[model samples]
Target: MAVNVFASATEAGDTAVPLGGSGVAATVDCPDLSERLTTVPEQARPDVDTELARLDEQIAAAYRQLQEAARTADDAKLDEGAILDPLKKERAGTIERIAAVIGKAGKRPEGLDTLAECTLRRTEVATTDAPGGSPDQQRQQQNGKGEEPGNTGNTGNTGDDGDDGQTGDGQQPGNGGQAGNGPVAADYADINSVRPNVVQAPRQKNASTGSFATSCGVNAEGLFNSDNLIAAPGVSNGAHHFHDYVGNQANDAFSSDEDLAAAGTSCADQGDKSSYYWPVLRLQNGTVEQDAESPGGGIEGNAGEIVTPAEVTLRFEGNERGEVTEMPRLLRIITGDAKAFVNGDTNANASWSCTGFEDRQLKDKYPLCPSGSDVVRTFTFQSCWDGRNIDSANHRTHVAFAAADGTCPDGFRAIPRLVQRVVYDVDAPSLQDGGRTVPLFAVDSFPEQLHKPVTDHSDFINVFDEDLMREMADCINSGRECGPDTPPGSEPGQGENPQEQPTENPTKDPQEQPTENPDASDPPAERTATASAPAVPGQDGRDDGESEGKGGGSGAGRNDGQASAPPAQERDDDASPRAEPRAATTPADDTPDDASGAAPAPGATQGTGGGEDAAAGSATEPQATRGGLAETGSGLGLWPAAAGGVLFAGGCVLLIRSRRRSM
Candidate 1:
């Protein structure tokens, strides 16, 4: 099933369609059964997880089949025969297996077979033009008040200029890049033209303002896999898209919690064993990657040269409303929807922008940065955690997002939020020539996702030991900025500049530290000097010699016209590892909670908001404690509940005063 990495064209009825053109394409859309399994019994969790992953595999296979079908193919015939009907049967059997497992433990989920039937969803062809001009300019042009900007023209360039599909030697240009799959010319927009829509979340007086940065090299080790240990444990190729891993190295579909606990990390501080990974970004130039024949690669419609990030900054920031609690070890979290294209964007959380234009974020379109400006991908993870479970049956219920006002829901506690920023040095693709001049770049995604920018996402599994976790919490609560290069357990401003007083672990391996400099023997932890702004080359805090390419295997030596990522930039609201406390206007928390712990109906939005605000009580009390009181008071008589509330508030105040004095 390995696709020709350089496929120049796909059949389209009687005519032979040339490669790299835009038009409506059909994709498979099925109900997300995972979101509906809210309360699987603990004993059946493993079997249930495996079956859910099978559902994804079934859909992926159907999508690949759809790709083989020509555009002019009959939908009715295909649905009942070649595609939909077969997919439905497979899905039904899988659903039955899932139900059987749950039935062994508790009440079996019913009517899941009804979700087997899926349909082809038509996707609109994306625009490839780099639209320019300010929002004001756009408004004026719409009213015939002004002329459209020059960059705005030629947007309809179908990528089929005069060049023949075949090059002189009979090889397809760039090895049939773009693969007629996606990332059409319209998927990219000019960053300068985007209006500044980033709004920082308003911080309350009790906000935890401190920040901690982890210095995990930009995945220089090149650890990659298609398995999603969190979502699809024990299932191979569960993700069907390669993920570049940076923190914990012992991760795979079959990895156990014990394995992760004992594994090594790429992080400068070994104490932080958290795994941070996201889909790999590939250049659509015809060069075939090593994974071209693998399940997550060309076989899955993801082709081209894999690009290693020039800069990766993993920073943990404090809550805006109050102090953050330590994330329990092994707590699993997934941010952004990997299947957002078909999932309807209910959980899309990643943003795209350019290095210098971080203020302007794009949820759907990729940015066409000016020559010197590199493309940037930013992921802001959920910061609120339920005090109980490390993971829920649906994998989403244990965590939630803070409200627009920056308060965690009534029952969820605020935890340090992880903000990941990845940068790539790449030349803008030539939309006029359909990426023939400069190939397009896209993030790896499910075959059906069409490599859409909206589907970009990241994953995290917290593995910080208790001592390190407590230190992180204390640092944030005390308003101290700390980082991997900072001295272990150092106070504010003490190790801000590692160049001044360096901390060294004598027993650590020299190879553990990845540096841009080949000759320099120092590990990344010893060189905590501030790097220049991202706009400047060698911004990764290393000298020119240290800014060499980080990609290995097939990705190496492919830099003829490619750009290297500009190194580390100083921390800032937009460019640094520290996440800005910004109000998310995307209505990320609008989903309602399911009733009586039952899963929501298929296709219904899952609740992402922290539960309703805790009943009125001492502001400093634990969110869970306050929530419990609120629920209890609802059942008592009015007079008794009032008296209890007053007494509880007084007791909380007294307890807080006593604790503060002790401190």
Candidate 2:
């Protein structure tokens, strides 16, 4: 099972073709054409969007050809004539069509032909345990102390070497089933060996200190898709990877803004129709999933069984410097780069760690958790909104991350930051055997990405009703800690709060307990909301029951009318509930844990700004705020956690590009 680990970044990036364990493998890397556009004519937007999607498909087809050529022919050359030239030709035509559409309604874009030509790239992974590298050299490159040739912006360390011996299974060590693509031995690190690099930003006097937690059930209903409406509208199989979706159910490639608004939701609070999605993680154990033979699955190099999450937590945190404003309905956001392996880490935002070691976050590597500890993935989305568009030409320029000092860039408003945490309970894989005994798990990715840990990402869309959105903004601006089950001004453990402490089961919130006398077929009453929020009508005037769009709940009670019985669905064989063990207490020597379980009060004493109270000006209300030029936004992940103060540094700018070859 032993396979060749990349010796150095130089070896991998020296030429267009890099030698994998199986032979030469190449990927298509092209400039993001959409980012060059200053504006898209409103009438031509749809046609232009479709043409842009065509460009992606052209690249995908070329990459697929390269993979097939590598698998069958030894030392096959990725000749420009056979792959790149044809791809370029296809792209040039698509680019012209895009220009034609835009020219009819507005000024024609120039220099689009320059973006047609593509380059071949190989996965650039550096290894300390390999034959030609030293631990000190690897450590320096990982700590940003030094940069390897052609490996700029690669600040991830693979940690110290672990047990690397051949396993009895026939799988190759470096390749997790996909021949040249990865989940390689060098892509994982031991959590304890990594230094703690997390820094907390001090809250200023005018900061919004309130917190709001939402009870969106783990995707137990097995909702899975390969469509990305935001990135590639109207294009089926747009995202060449399977995504696990929560919140909204009717989110596919063709879903219109109105369709999503009227669709059903998976959240316990039905009023929140917002959609959240991320790539699904799969165990590379040779188990064939239902999607194994379909697009975005085995046909696209994504094999193995899909692993569902044990718990999911969706919490909204306030800005560190000032009061927050309500997010516009249909406002779209993407948190991490999905093609970071080849694109570089300028936009990479992945945070992988073990449940017990929450303090150590890995941006480019997956954590090989210790036994009894579960794997955790955290996504802290951008919290700032530009005063203008809900979506820009590149889908990112409309939103930006705050400055290091906790203030939004001028003209941008601070919005509630969504921190999604997902947890999975899987046994540590035998990397030596290439995950033969206990299967190795990797997140779903585009075929060319090769399942690199750095390419992990998530997507979101805001669909909250006006009143609820107002409540969330008020709670955060006022510095009150609230949950979906908590009233407007009340904090957890006050008023009708059901549970005071963390629950043992991560999937079932203690606050989501069912009513005592429940009907056999009726859904749970007060599933997640307090008396202040009311259930909204779903499509066809039907109310969303607990089992309406989900697989299993405890037949929970809700204060609602009975709808038709849930439609029958094929059981997801890969989804088996696993025990979620309690995480070990944070070591006392670490940074002071805020015992109040609430952010510092908004008007409290200054932090590093170090001053007395001052006049807090009115909050900046962006055009993306409620009731502006309304457009559309689209969907998408998490597993769960204990009830405690999880202070994520929200000051870091997280401007991520969409998956439409948007660099």
Candidate 3:
């Protein structure tokens, strides 16, 4: 039996036909038809197609499942087992086969003739499953330990394994390499070797007196009563001990019993009895401490109680003498929270006077009141003490203060007050003869607490008048006048002179004279040429001259005759001569020869000369010359005769020229 299949009759016709019942057949009418009989070997074709369809459906299902798994397996919700297990197993087997082929193929596997289909198929599955897997996970799957199939296929790991071929969980030493067992374990055997030693020290106490404990420790009563307390004969010495200890040392250093008694008396005079009544209190630390004292103790006794008014003795050393002075004046005295009269009363009843003891002069002056005075008093003294006065020669003065009764009050102290000597140390070179000295007065009161005097001595002034003169000189030198508007007796227009104005006067220019008259002869020749030509006649026998004249006896003939004559000869015979020498010497040749031929006859010369002279002076001199020529021609009849001759010659030439042309 046989069966046949054909694409077309043209292809089938060349092949032999099979038996009808047992083999495939193609009808002659349907040349392109193909058939397979049950008896033929191709009859199993339908079963083969069915098997292939089943296999294709299975492969398609597997591919779709793979795609669905890949789509859903993001890092956030990956299913490592369901997505990568089968692929990892397949990749391991494929890698083993590839390695075998590569080993047999030697250095270059590219030239080897081998089936790579399995390898490519396995690679596609492995790559899709292991797309972003970590290297360690990939290496674990490569070794065929039946590791969970979900393990990604990747590069093999080269790390050494522990027991059971697994890496140790313990951290390794030195770049994370595994530690050598025995040596590393033995190195840290003694735990105490690595422990740190620490010590705690006790805190020292603070010595600063900022706290109550420190301040309480000081002997307040002893400190307040220091000046009044007596001491034993021998105790502490040399060191800066407490006042009581220092007093004890002072008591021991005295040489005699009298000296010791005197020291005791001075101490008793301090009158600080409050120190004996105050009790010492024990601090919480069990140390004994002194209590602070109140006011009215020691020398500051009964501060508000006013005693008899005490004199504030002021001693001024080194005061300049005999000049009006300005200095700090001790006007009143201030005690503890109270002010009292030192010298003057509230009505300013105190008077100030200075007496030059050596010069025997008395000066009564009034004290200048300061701003803060409560009591302004004045004293009227006839004269001051000798030692308290100063003069120009006596620059230094020592002043001593005395009470009204000339005695100080008991238990009151007085500080020596100094009024500086007002001596001018003149710096000007013009004042080399030496500068003057004067006395300065005390004006302001002494302060309750005294401070060191200011020592800068650069600009000290003494006399008020001298100071006034210096100020005036400065004002003048600086170009300034001092007054309400300007100082008295100053020049009114000083420093304000007006600027002067300038004057102007116009000056005349020199007039220019004619250097030389413009060349007279040159101008005339140019003018003559430019003059209009006169209306005159030609030599033809036309009326070439004027016919009118006063005497009309052939005037033109007479003019012609005169014009034809020689002008030089006529000029020689004339009564009056011409002005220019060139005119006199000019020959008849200067005029045309026809003028000689046409000159007036000799009889008419007199009348013509007058006429010619008139015409020369008139506007038509050329006409006059032509008239003279015409008069000459008419008188001789030469013009008419020459005309006839010219006509005859013209007639003859015409006749001959015509005959010649005709012939």
Candidate 4:
């Protein structure tokens, strides 16, 4: 379903919705996000049982101390932060110890070489790794704290298969020809129904399938970490946690317009040199506190503020399918709500999509893409801005999803929709690896927590020529097929012929994979209109007219949006792929000829800490190591464990009071 790109573009004029109040777009360049998955390599995979056990023990012990302190503070009527600060400090120290062990082991998956990567791996492996890895432990902790904002039945955690009634893998990939099972967040009846009182205009008119359209993009070979991070100014390296970066190969937190202008880009289309990044979510090694802290951090299992996704893909597509279009200058927009971790709800506008198989639309979640299909993560940003706020407190109020009929809102001015499709190199589903069929990845979230993986999000910045943007908008609004080779004023079919569009190749990526049994001949999905969807706060993926409070409250209420996802009908299997998904042409670990993998990535933090003090380990942090990696070590003994028991008791008391206060 190609959307009307210009919903009455010209008529919208200057102050109209698509044009922003003054026919102008905010001048900052950035972008938004979405997700899908690819498997990480398993070679040289070190069994971190010993390291994890030690880390878990330390975390438990630390939590015990923290509890005891909190209780003591309560008894003494002291400030909780005062009592907890030291314990928090200790917990950080314990985590650093785990980093040390990871650093020295050097047996982790090859591509996941950064701390963030290890963090992600560790997190996924946590359920199976630690002594605390048991559900009993999790329940016990929850019991200690009573319950959290979204801690009921793990709402969307409906056993991957039961989550979305469409059958396997949460929800059917493309139900009812709808090629998407975007991350299902909590109910957003409040926001979706009334806020965007503005009506949509008609912008989409082009009918091209983009078959001959050139596929220009960037591939983030590996994550980077460094002291020159630009987001965390004045801070060393980056934040306490690292940030994943792509696009400008040389970009760091400290990168500048001039630096970016001068730096080489990873994009096949060099003209698209904008930098992309977000906080890297680290999977906790057993060496530290891996479980989500209550009132301690923002979300449950809060390893970091955000879950590090497996990959980041970015691209552009519009009415000018025949040629490429240069992005406008410094136009930035973040999609999906970052505060979701804090809010415990999913923003409906995060257009979660899947890639890899041809024919099938690019936005289906967990679709079994055919062989040779590129595994793409395409995030569509909200085009209808309030024009008043660059960002809202909730990270959503300022934007909104486009009308399902493809119309721009009354307050929004039509602009060329920018789609950022990040491609991961994961291969088709691997049958090996213990008959388990190596699992596909998805947008990261606090594991086992109410907020499931479906809570995918993204950020974007438009750094293109303004004139070029105007031209592209004109192309889209006017329904013209313009490309880099054919600007708006050029004659039809007389523009520069672009190099042959890259064939949909999935093997270039080391971890990139495709579906195990693809449903063939599936035409492109009709939900592509999500490309220009409005992304505003409280727009929690609910229909515009959904009545308020269908099921409002904690975790379960938030999942009401997702509850609708499961009931979808599965794709008809009788249908076959127009083109058969072929077998992997290369080995799972094959590095491409033009491939970019090298030694430890620049700016990416490599593990060097062992089961000891990580003070001298890496550039990210400085903390003391205690009870270095071990499984009930003789050196550390049962002292910490014993102490934890006492603290646990005190913790229960403090929490009881805390819950009362919240009530």
Candidate 3 lDDT tens digits, 126-223? 11122111112223334543333322221111111211111222212111101010001111101111111000001112100000000011121233
Evaluate model 3: give its lDDT: 0.18
- Give the range where candidate 2 is weakest over 10 consecutive residues by summed lDDT: 539-548
Please list the residue runs of candidate 1 whose C-alpha ends up more than 4 Å from where it truly belongs after superposition: 1-24, 71-80, 126-175, 488-663
What TM-scores do the predictions have? 0.68, 0.67, 0.10, 0.38
Model 4 C-alpha lDDT per residue in residues 290-333, reported as the tens digit of each score: 32343212222233222333333232323212222333354456
Q: How do the residues 192-213 of candidate 1 rate in per-residue lDDT, one tens digit apiece?
A: 4554333223345676766566
Candidate with top lDDT is 1
* lDDT computed for candidate 2: 0.55
Candidate 3 local lDDT, residue 344? 15
The model with the greater lDDT, 1 or 3, is: 1
For the record, the alpha-carbon RMSD of candidate 1 to the native fold, in angstroms, is 19.8
- Kindly report which residue stretches of model 2 are placed more than 4 angstroms away from their true locations once superposed: 1-24, 75-78, 125-176, 491-663
TM-score winner between 3 and 4, please give it.
Answer: 4
